[model samples]
Target: MTILLWILIAVCFIASFVGLVYPIIPSAPLLIVGFLIYGFGFGFTELTISFWVIQSVFIILLFTLDYLVSSYTVDRRGGSRAAKIATTVGLIAGPFIIPGVGLLIFPFVFAILTEKIISKKTWNESMSIGIGTVLGILSSALLKGIAMLLMIVVFILYIV
Candidate 1:
């Protein structure tokens, strides 16, 4: 049972990272679930109050990063709400459709097309938005990846 719980917790942590690419997965919640499993299955004895507080802050940061980074990037490039929406859709669909590169390509293409067709932006502006979307995706992933690493570190420090 102990090993099984640990495996489940590890899966949650991994899935949380995977969620960075596939926005449909609830990344923060998965992390919380992993912690909860530790608390319940093994014991919460080592998980001090500070641990929870720090994790809570990281959770908030994760959520904020997810929303602010991508939106800000697109908006800075004069992208419309439609472009933002399409970028999200592309993020979710990209990996499955075209594998690794699709992650970047789909969002870029989607953002540009949405700007051109739905927002009636010029080709130049549309291209700018596409570039912004890709940049946003890359930066957001970098930040979130760091945060996730710190989160896991905190968990490890608390337990061992």
Candidate 2:
């Protein structure tokens, strides 16, 4: 591959690593981009279209599975539909107002508000659910990060 191609792959790799920590950045997809560079642009040419297709299906499955796993954890931990909606709003709004810390606080505020409204829970219970939801999301993200890191290692092993 050309220098430019390799440069682009390098950029994707770095971005994927950033995604590992940054909640907003999508790490797994970025890793997939790097894999695509190797598989489609060069390295896997002799491996056949069927090979690439099968590999692609596997990659997409990983992405979907990670998503489901995280959301499932949040839902299983008593996160209600309203709580989820509010948490999403908080997550989006938090960053604009508070930046780094907002990432943790937004979902918390949303969960509390949602719990208060729908569940008619006391302040203490609302707060508990809020904290629990935040913890769930954080844990899910951590697990997903681990999975993404493993995918990155695989890509590096195969491509590099």
Candidate 3:
């Protein structure tokens, strides 16, 4: 029983990391679920109030990063609302289409097309916005990944 619980917890953590690349997955919730499993399995005596407070902060950060990072970068690059929407569509559809590289390529292509066609931007400007979209995605992923790692570490510290 103990081993099974450990495996379940590990799966949740692994799935949360996978969510970094596949934005469709709810990364923060999965981590929280993992912690809950630990609590339910072994009791929450070890998970103190400080642990919950810290985890809550990280959860908020994760949600903020998910909402703001990509759009913020696109907006900073002068991408229009259409471009931002297109970029989001590309990010969600990319992995399903190209398997691995689609995530980057689709967003770049979508943003550029939206800027050049819908926004009436010049070629160079469109490309710049495209680049910004990709950068934003990367930035969001990196920050979220770090935050999730910290969450896991905190969980371990509390439990161990």
Candidate 4:
């Protein structure tokens, strides 16, 4: 049973990493969930209060930054709600469709075209949103990466 749970946790961690590329799955949240379950599911014998508090804060900050920074980036670049949704869908599809550069290139081109067609924006403004979507992805990833790093360091210091 312990071995099974450990395997499950590791699988969840892998899923979380994959989720980073596919927006609908929320990789960071899943990662934190795995950590939380690992910490609590076995009865919390090894967790210090400070460690829990630190992890809780890191998880909170991770999601918070991911959402705020990404959405704000889109909004700043003139992307509407529809643009975000379309970009997410495109991101998922692009990798399977074209592979490699398709992941980045497809989202950008799709976003630009969608904005131009749906929102009826000029080519220039539509292009701006494309750049913004990239910025949003980068910013959100950066913040999440930092939070995860902090959690890893804390976990090592406090538990392992």
Candidate 5:
């Protein structure tokens, strides 16, 4: 039973990493769920209070990075406030509205359109911001993936 539980935990960790690539999937919360499963399965003896607190902090940082990194990148690339806002809106709405591809594409499109129409930016400038938004999102996903790996390693250390 313990071995089976460990296998399940491994699956969850893999799924969380895949989620980082897919965008529509909720990777960070899934990682937290994985930790919770470990705690429950193993009677929580190894997952100390300090461990839980540290995991909680990582989870919070994971979610915040999704927003902060993208917005910061857009702003740094000369995106207007409206462009940033539109990118955020697209980030939230795209996955649900159009599914897999939308998650990757909508934010870029929205940022460009918002910059061009609302900010009166030329096409070249708007495109640059749009690219920045996409790059920022990708970078955040990469960082989150690394963090998830760290969390998994910590959990394994505690359990073993």
Candidate 6:
């Protein structure tokens, strides 16, 4: 039973990592769920209060990082507030509306359209902002993937 539980936890962790590429997967929440499964299965003997707190902090930090890094990247590239907001909305909406392809297409399209419509920017300028948004999204995804991996490692170390 214990071995099976651990294997299940490992599968969840792998899914969380894959979530980095697939926006709909809900990676951070998946990580917490895995931890909870471990806690319930193993009785949480090694998962002290401090350990829980630390893991919670990491979860919060990584979640915030996902948004902040992308927004910061857009801002650094001179994207307006509306562009950033649109990028975020696109990211949230993409996976639901069109699944895998939407996740990749919506952010860029939304950012460019937002800039052109809301900011009254020329096509070239709007395209530039959209490109920045795409880059930011890619960078944030990479960072989130790394952070998720670290969180998994920490969870395993504490539980073991």
Number of the top candidate by TM-score?
A: 3
Output the better candidate (4/5) by lDDT: 5
| Model 6 residue 2 CA deviation in Å | 2.8
| Native-to-model Cα distance after best TM-score fit, residue 141 in candidate 6, in Å | 0.9
TM-score of each model, paired residue for residue: 0.93, 0.73, 0.96, 0.76, 0.83, 0.86
lDDT of each: 0.92, 0.69, 0.93, 0.76, 0.83, 0.84
- CA RMSD per model (angstroms): 1.4, 3.3, 1.0, 3.0, 2.4, 2.1
As a whole number from 0 to 100, the lDDT of residue 154 in candidate 4 is 69
Residue pairs with clashing backbones, model 6: none
Q: Write the per-residue lDDT of candidate 3 for residues 52-138, one digit (tens) a residue.
A: 999999999998987799878998999999998898899899988987688899999999999999889999999999999999998
How are the candidates ranked when ordered by lDDT, highest leading?
3, 1, 6, 5, 4, 2
When 4 and 6 are scored with lDDT, the better candidate is 6
Candidate 3 Cα lDDT to native? 0.93
Per-residue error (Å), model 2, residue 139 = 1.1
Number of backbone collisions per candidate, in order?
A: 0, 0, 0, 0, 0, 0
For model 6, how big is the CA root-mean-square deviation? 2.1
The reply for model 4, stretches above 4 Å from the true place, is: 1-15, 24-26, 33-43, 99-102
Cα RMSD (Å) between model 5 and the true structure?
2.4
Instruction: Write down the worst ten-residue block by lDDT for model 4.
Output: 16-25
Candidate 5 residues 101-157, lDDT tens each?
676688899999999998899999999999998899789988888888888888888
